[model samples]
Target chain A: MRHSSGFRAFRAIGLLVFAAYFFIPLLAMFDFSTQVRGSAEGRTWDNWAFMVTDEDLRSSIVASLLLAVFTVVLMVVLLVPTMVWVRLRVPRARALIEFLCLLPLTIPALVIVVGITNVYSWVTYLLGDSALVLTFAYVVLVLPYSYRAIDASLSGIDAATLSEAARSLGAGWFTVIVRIIMPNITGGILGAAFIAVALVLGEYVFASLLHFDTLPVAMAALYKSNGPAAMAAALASMILVAVLLVGLTFLSRDRHKQGASS
Target chain B: MVGAFQDENGALTLGNLDALTSEAALTALKGSLILSASTAIIGALLGALLAYLIVSMPPQSLMRRSTLAVSGVLAQFGGVVLAFAWIATIGPVGVLTKAMDDLVGANIYGSGWLFGLPGLVVVYCYFQIPLMVIVFAPAFEGLRPQWREAAVNLGASTWDYWRHVALPLLLPAFLGALLLLFANAFAAYATAAVLVSQGQPIVPLMIRQAITSEVLLGQANVGFALALEMIVVVTLVMVAYNVLLRRTARWMR
Candidate 1:
């Protein structure tokens, strides 16, 4: 297709408009965080210092890390076996299983919190309000992304052939799955885990509803009370997420290369 | 009912599981569906338009690459920050609202749709467009150059080419993207809660209310039921999209 100058000019204008729209808010956030306390004085590092020094903020960061790790672990434990089983034993139902796994993606976080709270209120009530319930909801929240990554990896492997080979070698179903299939799809599992960690870390609605103080919720609370400190937290979060996104992109690139080589 | 399991000391009991389907639970379920479906439809339409504009542009352009990158970032940057931005832009004391009120005698700030369904839709669109672009870009790339040339060579007008050749090829991808947009919009909570009026209860807001209420005071079971209902509806929509994808897989080629 040939490009025209008119189209080129239009593209430039569109790009500029969209770029400004996207960056202005981010700039505003930066400005809010850096401006001197209470006055329009020039930028300072006070907000960052405050965000780091606050015990509650520090605790929320630790809590977020814990929650994310738990969510990632739970997701892998729940999704990998179910996905492998569906792929190997119930191939025809792969579509159905995939649908069920991704079902959480359709639910709003608040709604899931609502459902889980209702279904597990007795559990929460009994446990005296532990973070366990929030962890379960986070598991559901990351299910779709984890399932997609795992399912895609499963599709790349010849599950039937691998299972057959393992069985002929006198391996039990559990052993074949544990020693053979899992080691093969480690990349996908890792990729999914990374993505799951990011999602769980960023999740706010579920944690807030469940009364757990995850990072995002904590940041939001701080933003309401003290805007500058919240901006520092937000910047920290953005940096963390950017690193994870880069890692995922690299994993995806490696996967592509592996696919091509095979 | 689930609360029934909580003893004086807040311990769990098997008996509390039965509270998952109470009257309050049913109401929350209904509210989630209505809110999710409404937001999904609105978001899907706006997202489709944004995706179309992005994809329809010429290749190798800076605009295309930047749009792609920015959309990727914005799509992920939702929640409280997004809510704050929207308020900054159009809330009662917001720049846009104040300007409009001063210039046109229109009080669009706190009095009108800006704080209600309209505001929700606007916030939903902010996230939805980028998502749609992500999903639709590849679908658009799948369009064969020869098809467009063939349409032109056959004396078809631009409109005819788009209607007859492009739309058919893009329908499956569009539907898939729409399903995703629906899911994202339906599940969204914080943006709406922050931007919209508290009096107008969306399912998420309602759930939050129930959860935050005094122990043994609010209808938490109903909130759970509402969440369940949302899950079911989103599941059904996804299944339907998958079926459509399978059926149209050949056609998309």
Candidate 2:
């Protein structure tokens, strides 16, 4: 554990280099967002205010937030029970389930947007023209990440034994999943939900290509006429996502420490 | 979607592949490959170094934990937000550019190449490096200090210990992380889409063009074909990554 001065210096310099690379642009975003337009040396809040004041941008922001909520709800509803049941009853299909969940990682979202045109035509025809239909695709997008999070927590508990005991005591499948297994994986569920929210907020390809106005698509559109406003929006969302992810990291880390102590 | 790859008679054919051979398509493909490969190499090297530094710190240290938390955030930080981040830093009227002009009397912002391939590489590396750190750090953790101590006690100098004992063990994991970064950069669409608006400097932009501005009626089919092409390339890279991961897991476990 003894370190030479040279190695210590190397490590210090390396950290400083990375710190600069990462932090400078963020600081620049803050500076850029507040710069007074058509003025030489003053700051203004108009760009930041435009986020709420502009009708198009404000609606897109609302749409994106709703998409995040629906995506989280859909992801949890669809994935949690399937993952838990597979781990319990159909252990034989665990590999297949995992592979399916992780398939989106290999298939880019662009490919999905390209191929889903046919499917979305039916979906749009049936559901009417609304952006919320994107909830289905967003669920698919977050599957691999949320699956890993939920699966880790699922594996950490004795799901089979707990469910068996519940079954023996006359608790139905719904009760077992909702009351028992869900409580145990709340940390993972929260982690997955935070990630999903962050991702859905920043998603652009699907919204832009599909002609649905979302936060990022709106930011891109705003960037054309109002660069400062778009930069402000981008910085704001980036900070929001950073807060969510950093919080998730702390949550998972605390859970790990608790698990280790126990 | 698969129908895009078929001929008029509904038979699967290489007719769509003809679209890829066009001058613009080839340029975009070349640009994509070059961008992905360069970013992978740079990200792998720098991110490995950063990971090594963080791993050497005490596990409970705030610096180590925060670096990891920040890396997790940054790794997922891509798309239009990322493009705006860089522009805010170095765009024509950006903060740093303005500050430098005022204070240092030096205009570092040239003819705005940040809207092109060089800029794309810089922006992509911002995310790619953090992703590399996230994926490669576990490999660094897998290297038990006792192994290094054992090598040292057995007459290995610092360089000798790293060269002979560490490098060989880390190579497979390093390559695996490199491939993962490569695929990450390759599949990235949003940043390029936002940053480079005028021309199709990359395949993702080309795909965007095919989708949005269908000069011809069936041009969207070319986008489908290109998506298929992206799927094949990413699938192959991931398969190789999985193989390397299995190798890493053997000794790592």
Candidate 3:
């Protein structure tokens, strides 16, 4: 397509506007995290120090990490085989399965928290309340993203050919999936795992509603108590997300390279 | 767990679940539906406009790269930070609020639509626009130049071309984006909780209150009931969206 100077100028303006919109808030958060007192003063590390020193803060961070790990494991176990089966055996129902996987996207986390709390309250009355209910909710919450990554990966392979090849080698259905498909889609699994972790780490509504002490909940509690320290926690959370996003981007780039080379 | 359901209160039965439905709860449900639907419509329109404008511009590699980066950031920025930024800009003590109050002797802070429903719709629009762009931009890119030229050659008017050809192709993407926008808006709590007043509570806020009060006061059964209600509603929405996505994608096969 041909271009004019007017078009170029308009493009530049649009880019700048969106860029500012995106970056300004993040920069403000970072500024708030470092700033001493209520206002944005000269740079200081006191907020960071406070965030690190607080015991509940540390525990919340650890709990968030555990939740993320649990979510990733659960998502992989459920989604990997489902994606493989849909692609290889149930192609007709692939769309149906995909829709089922993405259903969580439509349901708000807050609503899910509410619903599960009700069901679990009955269970808690019987089983006694545990963090297990919260973990189950996290699995449902991360389902949409996890399914997407795994589905995309499964679609990338020749499912029929691979299954046929494994069958000819006298491998059992389970063994073929475990030994062949699993190794082939490691990239997708990793990407999906990271995405799940990111969602779990940042989740606030579910954790808060369930009365579990995740990092975001802990931060919200602290925000009510100490503004600066909470800001520091928020900044740390953003940084954690940024790092995960960067890693995912790199993995995506590598996948693209492999795709192109092959 | 099964036995817990057997426990009963005097003169209160499972058949009386209807009694729990009150005017206040009904009002909140109605408000949530209205707010979510309106925001999704307005957001999708504004987003499509923005997407169209951006894609129509002559493609520069750097421009495309930067746009993706920016969109990624904006799409992911949710929760407290989103609420805080908007509040800082336009809340009661916000820069514009204080300025308007001082300059015009009219208190704009917490006094008008900007702080309540109107303000929420605007912020929701902000969140929705970028997401719409992210989802719809790829659809726009997938439109081959040959298709548009083909439409022009057929003597189809510009509006007719868009209405017939471009729209049919774009329908799946547009619906998918709209569904996503609706879900995000519907599910949203942190933004609304911080931005809106307690007198006008959303479903999530009500749930939060129920949980906290029940836990603190040891009213577990009531909280359980409320949570069950929320789960049922959310599950229905999820199922509806799933059906929509399947129906839309059926044509692609």
Candidate 4:
């Protein structure tokens, strides 16, 4: 159980090297975003201020966030029940759902964007270019991740027994999924939601190619006018995801600890 | 694409596959392969090292838990946001470049190579390394401490233990993560699109160009062909990954 001093030192150095590699760029971004350009006046909130003042950027941030909210809701609703149902009721179809969920991983984003461009014409014609319609594709993009996380959580629970237990108590099918299975997989669902938020926030190609004014697309567009400000927006977005990621870690960590103990 | 396989006279032929064989296509393929290969190799090595570190850590420790938590998100961190993160550090007007200019009278972002392969690799590795951890760590957890105790009981030193037991166990997992990373980097679109926008440095960008600016009318289908090629690469990589995963599962058992 004792780690040798040399081994400990090696571990420390390796972690340190990677931590620096990981953190420095983000730290630099924070510094760059705050610094006043062409002024002797040191750091300022100018870029952050610009994010508030720039109407388009402001709107894009809001729009993207709203889209994230919708996307996460969509993902949970669409995936959670289907995955749970397949496990409990139609275990034979489990493979089908798994393949469908993981289909996006094999198909490149470019191809998806290309193939879906045809469909989006109909989507936009029906829904208009409000950028919210991008949520459908975002759900597909998040499917593999969300499915994996939720499935892992589901695996930890005896789904059939739990469903049977709930059903024997006169719980309806919907109630079994919503009340029982949902509470059980909260950790996994949150983990999946965190990933969805990160993916939707930084999502670029689908948003840009589809002509949606999401935050990343806006950041790229804003880069031409104010590089530092765009970088600032990026830093803020990273910070948001980092916070979400931290939250996710805590959620899953609690579940992991519970899992190990139980 | 029908156009890609068509003859010069517009009759369907094997000639369009030549579009992929041209110097530009070859260069982009080479660029994609080199970048993806390096990303996979480097990501697998560093990520496996990190994974090993986590597996060694006290399971209840914050370090291991935090690493898993952070690695989950960081692995997925790529595309436009990633490009800007690097630019903020090392872009032409980036903080580091400016600092170096002030400190040593040299500009790091000079010559503009960051807009090319080297920069792409650095940015790509940001996500690739952590992804390797996410993909590889679970397999590492399969190493039973009882095996180590049993190995030691059998008079095996640590080096001998790894040589005979650990390395063989981890090799399939390491290679599996490597292939996944390869496909991950290869199919990536936004990072390169945002970083190196002008030229066709990789397949994804080439496809984007073909669709957006097909010089000839039928050349549009060429873009679809390129996308198909990317999907083929991804399919092969996933197949290899599934095979490795089965191999890993057996050893774990």
Off by over 4 Å in 1: A90-96, A122-133, A163-179, B1-70, B85-116, B171-176, B214-218, B221-247
* lDDT tens per residue, model 3, B1-253: 1222224221124443452386766676667767777888887876786687678766765555555545654666667656655554455545456567789976765565665667778777767878888877877877888888899899988799899999988887787778778767877887676566455545666656655673456444444554455556666666676676786666444
TM-score of each: 0.80, 0.96, 0.79, 0.90
Poorest stretch of ten by lDDT in candidate 1 chain B: B3-12
Please give the C-alpha DockQ score of model 4.
0.49
The regions of model 2 sitting more than 4 angstroms off are B1-14, B103-105
Off by over 4 Å in 4: A38-41, A155-184, A260-262, B1-18, B102-107, B149-155, B214-218
Estimate, for each residue in A1-262, the C-alpha lDDT of model 2 and write its tens digit. 6778998899999899999999899998888788877645889999999999999999988899999999999999999999988888899999999988888887778877887776677888999877889998899899999999999998899999999999999999999999999999999999999999999999998888988889999999988888888889999999899999999998998999989999
In candidate 1, chain A reaches a TM of 0.90
lDDT of 2 by residue, B157-248 (tens): 98999999999999999999999999999989999998997999888888889878846677777887788788888989999999998998
The CAPRI-style docking tier of model 4 reads: acceptable
Candidate 3 fraction of reference contacts recovered: 0.19
Ordered list by lDDT, greatest first: 2, 4, 3, 1
Model 1 CAPRI rating:
acceptable
Please tell me which predicted candidate would have the highest DockQ against the true structure: 2
List the global CA lDDT of all models: 0.70, 0.89, 0.70, 0.84
Could you tell me the TM-score of chain A in candidate 3? 0.87
What DockQ do you compute for every candidate structure?
0.26, 0.63, 0.25, 0.49
TM-score of chain B of 3: 0.81
Task: Arrange candidates, best TM-score first.
Answer: 2, 4, 1, 3
